[model samples]
Target: MGGGHTGASERASARATERARSTRLNAAEKEKDERQKNSPNATKAIAEGMNVISTTSLKRKRSVMKQFRGKESIFKRPEALPPRFKNKDVPDYHKHPHKWVRYTLGDVSPEDMSDQSNTAAALSFLRELKERKELIDTNNIELEVPPETL
Candidate 1:
């Protein structure tokens, strides 16, 4: 019991001494600040701590980006198909005033029938290939019997 009391008193004395030292440091700092303010080249100190991180970056994660690099679309920004009216070169052929086509616009025109050559556009290709029939003819009699067994 006697030893405990002495230990308590020692701790109290140590705390008091520490308080006095802290007070002296604070006073000295205040005086230094006043002197700096009085000087022509006074500059305010930037109090940046050790933990001045702008953003939290986990070291475990090599990349800050979300998984799949947002290719999966869940973590990605929203997108949409651009409007078709981007330039003047693209021509709109709808006869109706609306943006969609009419069910039967100019279906049977007598003028179109009269000018058949004007309505047609020719494509360049091999004449022999165009006249040739399909290679596979399931209706052929020769296919029913195999020439030689596998």
Candidate 2:
């Protein structure tokens, strides 16, 4: 008799658990349906709120910009300031001269003089300068002065 009573209690507990689960499921389904029905209204409210916020922000920004625009000095600078440096009549050499020197290793082409390296290219350049009498060898020059002249 005790075993039968325990068995009946177990079956009643299982049925109670199942009924609670079904009630929860039904509540979840009702909530979902309510949300689906009210979603359009919620979205409309959110969109209207966003539009109001954006328009207020835009108006505030416009007002700030207008304040900044009005803060410009009333006394404007004269437009005729001797035309500055634009029309100051530069010389022909300053405007457009011939030779433009770039003292860089990359500027010296190895193919032009068939130079193997940058040092060789520089040496060849110095040699050309010496041939043209532009580079004077000052290393051999010795300063000599008479003792009485000092």
Candidate 3:
């Protein structure tokens, strides 16, 4: 009986030692910086994730009113181009362009913008500038689209 108790204690001690070693190893792994492990791939992943929601897919959004305002032009013409802005004029109620920079996802820094969750920093920065009354809205007028009065 004495020999059996010693053998059981030895087995328990061995298991305790193994458990301690495993716990220490896991701690060491966790101590390593998360940024280091994810590195460059992490940045790329974040950018790709952000692009999944931006302007590139804007055309896919559906508009409720598809009725033509007038008869279509008979002559075949080239597609209308996006608005041309040689110099973008913001409002006095808005932030100066210099104060607010555009941070494209995959090409921008989170430090410049407020949201750490997504690459919406550029938009956030613009809104903040406008809120601060640093921008002027002469060339930066907002157009009101009248709702369809059914």
| Model 3, position 82: C-alpha lDDT score | 89
- Which pairs in model 3 have colliding backbones? 90-136, 91-135, 91-136, 91-137, 92-135, 92-136, 93-135, 94-134, 94-135, 95-129
**Candidate no. 1 TM-score:** 0.28
**lDDT of the structure predicted as candidate 1:** 0.53
User: Can you write out model 1's per-residue Cα lDDT over 1-150, one digit (the tens) per residue?
Assistant: 899999999999988987876776568567656764564333322234334422222331224233325342323465887776756555465334577755863786766566554445222234444544333443454577677862
C-alpha TM-scores of all predictions:
0.28, 0.27, 0.25
Please identify model 1 stretches exceeding 4 Å from their true place: 43-150
Tens-digit per-residue lDDT, 85-111, candidate 2: 755687666667665443666775657
What is the C-alpha lDDT profile of model 3 across 1-150, one tens digit per residue? 799999999999988987876775566446434533355554554678745443322332222113223534324778899887846866644756676766658765656555554457567887898876644453344333345732
How do the candidates rank by TM-score, highest first? Answer: 1, 2, 3
Task: Between candidates 2 and 3, name the one with more favorable TM-score.
Answer: 2
* Candidate 2 stretches greater than 4 Å from native: 41-150
C-alpha root-mean-square deviation, candidate 2: 27.3
- C-alpha lDDT values of all predictions: 0.53, 0.62, 0.56
TM-score of 2: 0.27
